[model samples]
Target: MGVALRDIIADCKETLDLDALKGVAAIDAHNALYQFLSIIRQPDGTPLMNAEGQVTSHLTGILFRTANFVEKGIKPVYIFDGTPPTFKQETLDQRREVRTRAGNAWKEALAVGDIAEAYKQASASARVDAYVIETAQELLGLLGIPWVQAPSEGEAQAAHMAGKGSVQFAVSQDYDSLLFGSPVLVRNLTVSGRRRVRGRTITVSPERIVLANLLDYLGVSREELIEIALLTGTDYHPGVRGVGAKTALKLVRNGEFESTVAEKLPDFDPASIREFFLAPPVTDDYNLSWSAPDTDGVVAMLSGRFDFSPERVEGALEKLSVKAKQQTLDQWF
Candidate 1:
């Protein structure tokens, strides 16, 4: 559907005319690192390092985005993925394989002095260190946002908070929140004012979608819908060969999967799947509460350690201060 979480934010910004965000809590997908920093070893044994002798994008994005959202006045709650579902491992392995092939292609392009292709391929080759979920947690502490390391996806943590009436909505660019059965998943929670991407000025108008309503229109149970999604594909499984939303639903509705396929379900592995739905359980890991924005924490993490500009960090603080004042004024009115 190309229906990204960021798309939701863009649409919300366009349609709802949302004010500087006042109440809703925002959640980050991972550590918000910008680039890959680990190591890439070749077949014979060679290492890849930038001119600076290290990787930084993945770490940098964490600092940048935390400041980014705080400035926009959204209270961010950073969540990191912990132990994952067993089925997810196959997806991760495939991603590395693709990156390896792409990296080789890029390396070949670079060797030939093809500047564009070199830059592209150089980008393709470094695939080792993108996993920076830990940095996200650390940065969250620094930015003063409460963070939860969930046993699984960050969206699941965000969804649980919203479902239990703790915060307002789960915010991210991923559509999987709906699959996780979030009460509300606010998409595009990160778009800022539009700017030129290439020669053209790209306008970004972020928006939110009521997943409950979307589910209603789609006309399948949420469990089956997500399962169908899994069968079709996800960020976790891009283009899973045998399935898609419609087909998955058809299979779920049919209720005749072989025992081998049925064995993969999380619910099925549990002694009883009904217990999961019956209680609407909230995982115990997440915590959501605060005195105000953790301004000092934000500054310390970004400006102090990662070299984020002070002005950028302060800009976020200013927005949170404004939101706090607005609430105070509204109380009088």
Candidate 2:
């Protein structure tokens, strides 16, 4: 919800209270680590270190954070990426090209004495591959949490499982899950809202928005919803030049949805649109199992090889314990 990471993290502690993170099976963004590192290389003053020599701060940051969540008693099941959707490859390609161009622009900014642009580009580059699947796998291994190597976006696989009655819910910052038909999605997961309410600091529990409710608001079926997102432009696909979210929603609501979109698409083919919704971009060999998080294995992999922070790992498990007990008590009462 918030922009800056620092502000977001601060809000999480102030509002939702990290202490309350419990029993929730967190689906970690496996692709974010490599993403951040690819964007930000060490500055000129800092000579480049070999892969093995560099402290690998990116991995450490993720490991430390995930471990902390574990300590809070939330059972994190770190899902790793497999292959991406065929339809998404084009989008991925476009994003990578943009990053490459930005790198060039950053150099120019530095030459032209625009430190602000240079810094901004540096920050953007740092965001690339910050959550690489392999990194998450290594980190989760150390913390005793379970890890799932999905065949696509970790969240998509997680959402699919949740919607299909496999998991309780899917947790992620991305709202795209709604299009993927995930019934439940909780936002501000690692962030919180700040409400200064007088003498006592009252932290609100994290809020959630289910897709079903969103559907009710939009007055569209899940299939129609996906169609709606496609028209508006999603991460996976580029939408029409002029069409936007609200406009797309209006068209959907108006009538003869496909024909309406075709009218807008100077060259829109009903067949193409139909195929997109009939079988959206997804993996083939995706599998979902209700295997519990492997606490010991996760801990061993992270701690032994990745040198992950043990304290954070303990913190997530602690949260889980308290939540489990509370659930038990509530059931009895």
RMSD of 2: 7.6
Model 2 global lDDT (CA atoms, 0 to 1)? 0.53
1-333: candidate 1 lDDT, tens digit per residue:
221323222332324433545455646454233132222223222333234434445545455555555555566666666665554577677767877886787667757766555554554444434334555556556455677666665666667767767667776656666666667766545454454443256765545666666656556666655555555555544433545455555666686333424654434332222223223334775556433557787677656666667797677666655555565544311
TM-score of 1: 0.68
TM per prediction: 0.68, 0.67
Per-residue lDDT of 237-293 in model 2, one digit per residue for the tens? 565566666666677777556776566664654455445444444443433322223
Model 1 segments more than 4 A misplaced: 1-22, 31-54, 113-131, 193-201, 234-243, 246-282, 291-305, 311-333
Model 2 TM-score? 0.67
**Prediction 1 global C-alpha lDDT:** 0.53
